[model samples]
Target chain A: MRIAAARERKHDERRVAIVPDTVGRLSRLGVEVVLEHGAGAAAGFSDAAYAEQGATLTDLAALAPDLLLAIGPPPGEVLDTVRPGGLVVGLLGLATDDAILEAVAKRGLGAIALELLPRTSRAQSMDVLSSQASLAGYKAVLVGANLLGRIMPLQMTAAGTLTPAQVLVLGAGVAGLQAIATARRLGARVEAFDVRRAAREEVESLGARFLEVPLDAAEGEGGYAAAQSEEYLERQRALLAERVAEADLVVTTAQIPFRQAPRLVSGAMVEAMRPGAVVVDLAADTGGNVEGSRPGEIVETNGVRIVGASNLAAELPTHASQTFARNLANLVELMVTDGELHLDDELVRATLVVDGGEIRWSRPA
Target chain B: MRIAAARERKHDERRVAIVPDTVGRLSRLGVEVVLEHGAGAAAGFSDAAYAEQGATLTDLAALAPDLLLAIGPPPGEVLDTVRPGGLVVGLLGLATDDAILEAVAKRGLGAIALELLPRTSRAQSMDVLSSQASLAGYKAVLVGANLLGRIMPLQMTAAGTLTPAQVLVLGAGVAGLQAIATARRLGARVEAFDVRRAAREEVESLGARFLEVPLDAAEGEGGYAAAQSEEYLERQRALLAERVAEADLVVTTAQIPFRQAPRLVSGAMVEAMRPGAVVVDLAADTGGNVEGSRPGEIVETNGVRIVGASNLAAELPTHASQTFARNLANLVELMVTDGELHLDDELVRATLVVDGGEIRWSRPA
Candidate 1:
């Protein structure tokens, strides 16, 4: 069976669905990997690298394979060029991709939206969200530190002693924990907050202090954070504001899936921060965790910089694409056997959004 | 005794000669501090902060005092506003600053050039070059990592293992060693090269491999790497090119005092770097260590990013200014005894570039 990916067309989407390392994995599975010319250019994967890995570099029109891969959902024009009844897989933002879902249904094609994959240990290797969020968490601290006016680490020089910066990371999930780890590695005194009590051990394991909030049972289905009431959010923000006022760098990653990001920092809180303090909102694309933050922009309030970070993982395109390809390759390992594809595994079945002229998945309750 | 500083006017210069922390230190020395309004604003110090430390904030014309402070050389008009025969201290770039030197000499005023200060144990506390270079070194890695297309650290995620980046730092001087430390903190495997054989121990202590070239006696006076012969530089470049090609990030900080920075990474070497690799030249302002590097700009050659980092310490203005002010204060401590300024100490005499209508110091032999 042949699998192929065209160059990602979405602006600011630097990550490709395939990398050279993953090409060998698919090739080992008796899969012919075809890529459109310049498909991995933005992600630092040259066509030569793919060719060296025994993958074919061809025109978009000639990329009619049995399976099509993408980072973003491929446009209808590209989808129409796929082989009849071919399968397509990507981070199909199912909630907002009605047009692609309808087109796939009408064409009797198969679609696998990785975002809908079950968050289980058996499917952990294919968990793109966890992988990408970890990168976003790491990038958030880097972005904030880059904007800060002082060094993150302390120095006792002949000139004088420079105190370490105070870093406050909001959330204790994959991204928040990674942010804490990165900040701690840079010698910043890190403090993290999360409604999920179970995250405390993980946060402390990284040598960071986990701050406690009074509310409990904020854990949602699949170990993700559930939405909170307005009163709970108000109390949480009140506690965070005091800590944020003293932070040199703040990275907020308090995101609830398929919902607006919880606002954890108020405008007054940002204003209270000293000049040159930086706040990076990892949830900026889905509303924001800080007031006055806009997607993909930096807002300054009273000498404090609030960066609305969107698609931060994509900024580290080479590694982002590497892990993304590996995730897809892992799923392919389960489905492809004896040089033939079978969609029998429960892990594979869970990711199927559209198949056999019918929509297979719906928004989880 | 009174000391005052005017806001810097040079383009791209963000550091102030005095920070609020040093104002308190000076105040205890019976020195009445005066500052032009917003003198430290660019460095994140406010008038209120200075005022809290018993410093008077006023207009530039009204800052008549016994001593004037600056980051860059104060322009003629501002220098003319100082009290007659009063002292001025700053990084007076004596060699190329003919106009400022002439003006100071013509006015019969005393000037201290921090760059020319003796590098001795007694003067170590007042070593502005080492202090600022340390900050620049730390910032160089940050700037390079920010531009890189992959994460600096490694990760073994469920998706796959992401390898740590290979960072090559050239010239194991103050800046290069700091860059190595910062990269190692971020989990990058660093390799550093230096003409000075003595730098190997320091580089290895920071958990980085030292790439040694078969050379001897490269060390100059005062523990600084001296200028090398043309043949030595040519041989060094040949050795560095092979390592530079394999690095994900390269930071070059090989600078000779009062001399052009040696070209370590040739244009051909940069072109050999893979796409998305980054090179930050800390000596960019002093004729770059990398070929085609323009001061204060990012030059992309063959898809490799070459950052000509000028005044990197100024980018971290808060800490840069804090240490700068402390250095100046330490110098003041020895010169200003019993509430009066004296120019008697050998260390103080070593820094005097101009005094009594004559240039007191000349280019080193």
Candidate 2:
């Protein structure tokens, strides 16, 4: 089996699909690794380092491999270069991106979209969403603390005593839980909210208070919160405003994947916050969970700083790339049995979007 | 008794001598407070906030009071506005800045320089240096962590395990000790070094290892480490290089008041550090302890980031201003007994730089 690593095409996307260490891991599995020149440069991995791990490097024009590993869906022009029936693996988001699925079907490519990986104990090792969300959540707290006018920890100095900053994390997913943990590590008093009652234990385990809204459970598919009724969302927003007003920092990570992110924080809630309070909206790229969040920008709305941070995982590229590459390797390892590609595994069946010259949509359970 | 505050005149100097909360503290002492209209604006305390605390707001040109409280020495023209024989208090470096001392002497202004406060148990409450350095130390860790390409804490994910970052702090003084504590709180393995043997206990108490260098003790007057000989400094540099090379983040905060800060980390040492290593020099304003550091700037040399972070305390203006104001208020409280200025206490005598028509130079022991 042969695999090629492709450079990420998105602007400011520094994460590479594989690191030098992962290149070495794949080579040990009887796989021939190929890379386009400078593929891992942005992630602090050099071509020479890849060569030391028994990988071959070549220009895109000279690149033709049996399998292509990417961070996102490969650009259309690059997909044209892949041999017909060759495999393409990445966070293809085929369920949401119709155009990518159409092109993959036209090219007769075998596409494996990691985002469709089932949330099961067996598939946990190949979960890219959880790995990347962990990094984003940690980075969000750092951004919020840096922009804050007050220090995070309480200090009792010779002059006086300063109270610790109060932090609130909205949503109790992987990202929100990580934010709560990071904020607690910095000595901030943290609180978290979630529509799912199951998230309450996770929030409390991280030394944070779980905010209760007294609403019906809105648990969604795949262990995520499903879309809520309009009335529930309105009441949830009203209850959250009182907590938001008392917080010195709020990190919003309420994302619904393919749909627009639910608005959890309102404009009036921001106005009620103390001057110099900071809000980091991680869902800004998919329409923010905060009322006034602008994607990829920091804006001040009535003395509250709203930082719409998109692609926060890219900010910590070294570790993010390292963790993500392992996830990719685990999925590829399942597909190749005894140095031959085998798609009979149920995991492969669930993730395959394009195979055998047709778009194969398998709804993930 | 009446006191007025002058707005800071230095570029990027945002901290005010007083905050609204402290205005009420002074009011109870029967002191009528006057202010320059926008003195507290940069620190997030509005003019109306001060007025609500019974402070009278007025333009700087019309400021005439019995006492002037300031962060830095007021410009000569502004000093001339004060009534003759009136008192002035702040972090006025009278031991240095001969020009300012001369003007104070010529103008017959009663000046109490906080920089000269004795390092006694009783004097600790009025210790402005210790109070401000605590904020600077906390911020240095935050700035270093934010700029580094890796996360500070050890993370265990489904993909793999990441080791914690290694941190080194030089000069285990108030600032250095706080930096070590802050970095440890963020899950970094920290090490510290100080010429004073007494610092070893403080460093170890904070859950950080104390680096041992075989050398003679160089303890100095007023609880500060004395200057070392040329040969001693050279030998110390060689010993520190090995440790510096191993650290992911190094924060240097060694300084002698009114003297050029000691050169602790050499340029060769920084070059030997791994790529993406960060070195934050908190002594940059008084001649940085790191060779390549420039005041108020962040630069990269040989792939090592050197942040010349002078005035780091001012960056967190809200808490910085609050703590600093309380320190000033404590010193002022000792001067006024029964609604009259009483300079009989030795604490005031030691802090007073210029009294009557003569410059009273009291060398703090």
Candidate 3:
């Protein structure tokens, strides 16, 4: 079977779904690889590199293969090129968009989204979001550290002694934990808080003190935080306010999937911080946890600085791309064999969203 | 000897240098404690709590204590009340504030900063910065996860499958590493990059891929990235741009003590990323490693978000305050005896910045 990897239609998405290294790996597995011209350029792989890796260079029309791989869902034009019963795989943010799924079903095409893999131990190697969020977490701390007005570690010298800075992290998820570890390494004091009880041990294990607030834990299946009651949120806010006032830096990361981020830090809390204090809101895209936070903007309140950043992983590209490639490679290796596709893997079956002109798996009706 | 615990001078600070539990511990150590009324109120302790813990509530001027424990350096008024040869210990960020040290020296007082403890294994309990930074790192990742426009892990449904989000972490230091681990736990694909080669194993051990860039491995004495030549910076930037273009989120945590953060992400590099991408900068207060990144502001370049957060630890305040209190208590316990004072511990020697009108044990020149 032949597969075609094409350019992403989404604006600013320079990364091709398949890279030259993966092409070599695919070739070793006996799968025929085809590429649209310069598909990997944005990620630093040239068409020549794809050729060197044994992938055939062909025009889009001539390279119409059984499967299509893209960084995002296939655009209308690309979707029209797929053969009946063929598969298209990539990031299909289907919850927000239904047209793509309709298009796949209309075309009698099989589509799998890499983002929907379950958080199970057996699916660890196939997990892509964990790989990417890890990078975003590490990068956020470096950004915060760069903007801090004072140094992190204390020093004693004839000139005078310098005190270490204080840092507070709101969410104890992947990105928040990484920020704690990075800030600690830089010699800053760190503290973290999370609603999920399971997160407490992880936070403390990283050597960060976990702030336990009196709030009802509402975690859904798979350990995701479910939406909470207003009363619970208010109590959580009151408990957190005293701590917020004492921090020199605060990073808020609490968010629920497909929902607006819960408002955690209030206006009074921001007002209570020092003049030069800074707050980084990671939930700005979904309505921030901090009051007066605007997505992609900085709001200064009572001399305290509030930053609402939308996406944090793009700041470090080289590593991000390499990790993306590795994860994709691992997934590809699991689905291909003897230079052909193995469509029967349980992993593939689990992720297949649409096939044979119908929606195949279970989801919100 | 008589000792007084004064109120913190900083308007936003609420944590007292000595908490009620510690006051009880100090009382058992033969240390006479005089506390300013309402000193521990901000940290959720009442005057009655201090009283119950065996602390004497007294006016600052009338106390004339031989030792003073303060959350911050003593206010000018409190300092003026101290007798010659009195000791003052607290969270004085002396490295950045020379005036406080001068005040201690001029008054012929002994001053010790709790943040100056070494990072050896034996000193882990006394490592106040590590305790706080660990929390900061954990919280930073949570912030990023919440801000991200999509879910971290992939999910499968009959409607369609969701793709995993990609996360990039800049700097493999403590915070960055923790960010990597936290993001991984949340099911994001994580990649970490650091200038220090020593961090590779640590990053990898956490199950995150380490980005290896070709560069001179010139780590400083403390295993930090040393100041590099302009040529090296340029090379680092070029290499980083390739990876940044592919990430959904990027967290930057690289910084040098008392120096501007190394410029890592440029405007051109940011322009290459997908729209809705987020960047959380941990170095905004000093200067940002990302060009066009404003401290405490989210600068949107071609739809890419740059977040420069200053105080990440403050976001997780309850735990941060508790850990900081414990550190302060431990440091004081090392020098106080049965509600009294001792001036002869090696730990005290290392932390004491000024004593008897001179810079005692100051690092050579």
For model 2, what is the alpha-carbon lDDT of residue A22? 88
Candidate 3 displacement at residue B280 in angstroms: 20
Whose DockQ is higher: candidate 2's or candidate 3's? 2
Alpha-carbon local distance difference test for all models = 0.88, 0.85, 0.70
- Chain B superposition TM-score per model: 0.93, 0.91, 0.80
| Residue runs of model 3 more than 4 Å from their true location after superposition | A57-63, A155-158, A214-235, A299-303, A361-365, B1-365
Task: List fnat, each candidate.
Answer: 0.83, 0.70, 0.00
* Candidate 1 collision pairs: none
- Span of 10 residues, lowest total lDDT, candidate 1 chain B: B218-227
The TM-score leader among the candidates is: 1
Residue-wise C-alpha lDDT for candidate 2, range B264-297, written one tens digit per residue: 9988999999767899999998889999899889
State the displacement of the C-alpha of residue B287, model 2, in Å, after optimal TM-score superposition. Answer: 2.1
lDDT of the structure predicted as candidate 3: 0.70
lDDT of 3 by residue, A1-365 (tens): 77778766666565566766577766676668898886665555667878987899876767676778766688878888777788888767664565788888888888887777776766676566666666566555655654454445553322124467788898887678877776676567788888777788988887778876543344436222323656556666676887889887888878776567988888888988865578888878778888999976778775577888655654444344455555666777777776566768777887788877688755455
The CAPRI classification for model 2 reads as medium
For model 3, what is the alpha-carbon lDDT of residue A341? 62
